[model samples]
Target: MNFDDQPHRRLNQLTGEWVLVSPHRTKRPWQGQEEESDRATLPKYDPACYLCPGNERAGGAVNDQYDGVFVFTNDFSALLPESPDSQPVADGLFVAEPEPGLCRVICYSPRHDLNMARLGTERVAAVVDAWCREYEELGVREDIGYVQIFENRGSVMGCSNPHPHGQIWATGATPMYPASEDARQAVHLREQGSCLLCRYMEQELASSERLIFENDSFVVVVPFWAIWPFETMVLPKVHMTSISEMEGKQRLDLADALVRLGIRYDNLFQTSFPYSMGIHQRPTDGGNYPHWHWHMHFYPPLLRSRSVKKFMVGFEMMAMPQRDLTAEAAAARLRELSETHYLESL
Candidate 1:
């Protein structure tokens, strides 16, 4: 079947959800909203920015003057280490439970102007190392069940700051999405005797259609069931359950993949591409999950241009997630984009 030219639904094997893709709709004119891209240059250090080194944050805490990767408990953490430890209370229809967790922010660089895209591979590798270390430390905690590391870039993605940083939220209970993925991977392993993403990666490698860029350790691809306009997944070439499993070379390779992908994203539309990126790994809830395979997901909003973005509203919110661009087509566009950032290319 010609998926690129027809309307079809693709199954997200990890989540048991379907994404409706109507490739024909791409030909239609878009009279929708167009955002004004932020092209203003950011200073390397902003005294007013709370995340800058040595600056006093809103929480009235002074940051240390660290030169490289810096991590600390979030001044305003979404999750706290302390909470009432009690069983879920049930009274008639209402039920509630106390959730205890810890949230931390990791600054990728001392230079606020440099993001992952602009940061060299060495710098990016430091970020990866920090990620692995954070995962290992946080995952070992008896109270922590899941450690979620994610970054929200650009104002459109609800990122309040432009500083190069990401967050880690370790929770007492696993979140819904990761839990669903764990279930699916477990079932896949039990039924097929192989990792779900490993099998899926084998297929993606076989048919290079959906692949964007790949290194020795990782490959970036627009998933078969991508809902975003340029959604990409970074899968390890080898089977692994968590980031802590990464060795020296694997860490460098993964860093290379991230920087290269970030450059392509920025070069695609000649802007610092906005997206939400996160890592999903094994749960810390003490399960021998050989089925779990760690992967990174990048969900970008841009559609045809830097200003034009995909919006999830109406049917997408009421019904199911849908997209106009086919995954193959998106892959082709990204694959061809110059890895050199557009600003630098000029």
Candidate 2:
């Protein structure tokens, strides 16, 4: 079947969800308004920015004037570290439980204007190292079951602070998505006698249609069931359950893969693409998850241009999620974009 010219559905093995892909819809011309890209050059250091080094945060916490990577507990954390433990109260019709966790913010760079694409691979690798450290520290806690490392980039993604940083939210229980993935992977392993994503990665490598880029250790692809227009997943070439297992050189390769993907995203529409990127790994609840395989997902909203974005509305909200662009088509566009940032050309 001609997937690029037809309407079809793809299954998301991780989440057990299906996305409808209508590739022919791309031909429809858009008469929509475009958002004004924030082209104003930001200063290297914003003294007023709370995340900047040596600045006083709103919570009256003073940041250390350290260089390179920096990490601190969130001044206004969503999850509290000192919440009292209580069993889930079941009162026939209603039930509730107390959740305890820790939230931390990791500053990717001291520079306020730099992001993953502009910061280069070495700096991104440092961020990766910081992620590993936070995961290891938080996972050892008896109360923490999962460590979620994620970044929200650009004002469009509702990122309050533009400073180069990401967050780690370690929770007392495995969240819904990860729990679902764990179940799926476990079932896949039991039924197929192998890891789900590892086998899927091999399939993608053999097909090469949905693949964007690959290095010595990692491969980036627009997943077969991507909901967003340019959603991409980064998977380690080897079968691994967590980032903690990565060797030094493998981490460097992952960093390089991220930077290259970031550069391509920026060059795609000549804008610093906004997306919510996160890593999904095995739960830290201490269960042996030999079936789990770690992967990072980049879910970008941009559809046709910088301003045009896909929204979850109407059918997507009341029914199942859908997308106009096919995964193969999105991968092709990403594949064609330059690895160098657009600003570098000028």
Candidate 3:
């Protein structure tokens, strides 16, 4: 089957979801100049930076002199713990629930100049340890049901801060996306008597076309059903449902995978790559989710050129998500690129 000829195709494993990949229309060579900018050279220590050590935040709270990984409650949290009970308006059609959750910011390092890609493997491991601590602490809370760890890099990704950091959101219930995945996995497991993602990972590993990089513990691949041009997912070889369940070595391996993938992304455009990345794991609702698999998603916006980005507009907004590049092709390109930063030579 010529995937290029087909206008739309449905992914069977993902509940028959369709994506429009207009490869012919977007088959153009990249023509963007790589320019050096002072913005990339972040300061080692910014006295005025709110996230830096020994700095005062907006709410009159001061940060301690943290050297390694540090996590603190978001100065401005989107979800508060002291929310009132959810109220329903009209009938069951219109309902609103009070969201009670915790938002935390995890500082990757004391140095502001280093991005995730630039941070050494050992330093990245420290960040993973901090994530484990946060997950365990927040997951134990009776009020929390899901823990989301994510990073938004570059201004294009709507990140106001340039510091090397990520955010953690622990909520009262499983989110819509994860809930959908959970349902699908459960259905697949009941039908096939095996885990859904585990089976898919096995197929992907055998194909090897969509794979970007892999170590003993983790595999980074551009999923066959990826919606973004440069989208990728980092999956664990072993089926660990949540970060809290990860052992010390697995945690370190995860951190190493993150740093390596980040370095590749930065090298791709020779710029600080903009992406919305997040992890998907089992919910903390106390039920055993043997079907669920742990993975991280990286969604980058750049399409044919660095300056020109793909937007979900017109048909995409009205209909379904679309991409111009196939996942296999994207993965091949990323695999060809070196993990080292292009800017390191300059």
Q: What TM-score against the true fold does each predicted structure earn?
A: 0.96, 0.97, 0.94
Per-prediction RMSD in angstroms?
1.6, 1.4, 2.1
Superposed model 1: Cα runs more than 4 Å off: 30-39, 84-87
Question: Best-fitting candidate, measured by lDDT?
Answer: 1
Clash totals for all models, in order? Answer: 0, 0, 0
How does each model score on lDDT? 0.92, 0.91, 0.84
| Tens digits of lDDT, candidate 2, 237-290 | 999899999999999999999999999998888887899999999999989999
**Model 3 Cα lDDT, one tens digit per residue, 1-346:** 6766556564846545777777675556666654443235667998888889999988899988999998999989998895465554665687666668989999998898788888888999898888878888898898999999999988888998888899999999898888888889889889999888888899999999999988879999998889988999998998887777788888788888988898888877777888999888888878889988878889999865455687989988998888877787889889988987876887
Q: Candidate 3: lDDT over CA atoms?
A: 0.84
| Candidate 2 similarity to native, TM-score | 0.97
After best superposition, candidate 3 residue 326: deviation in angstroms? 0.9
Question: How far out, in Å, is residue 52 in model 3?
Answer: 1.0
Candidate 1: lDDT over CA atoms?
0.92
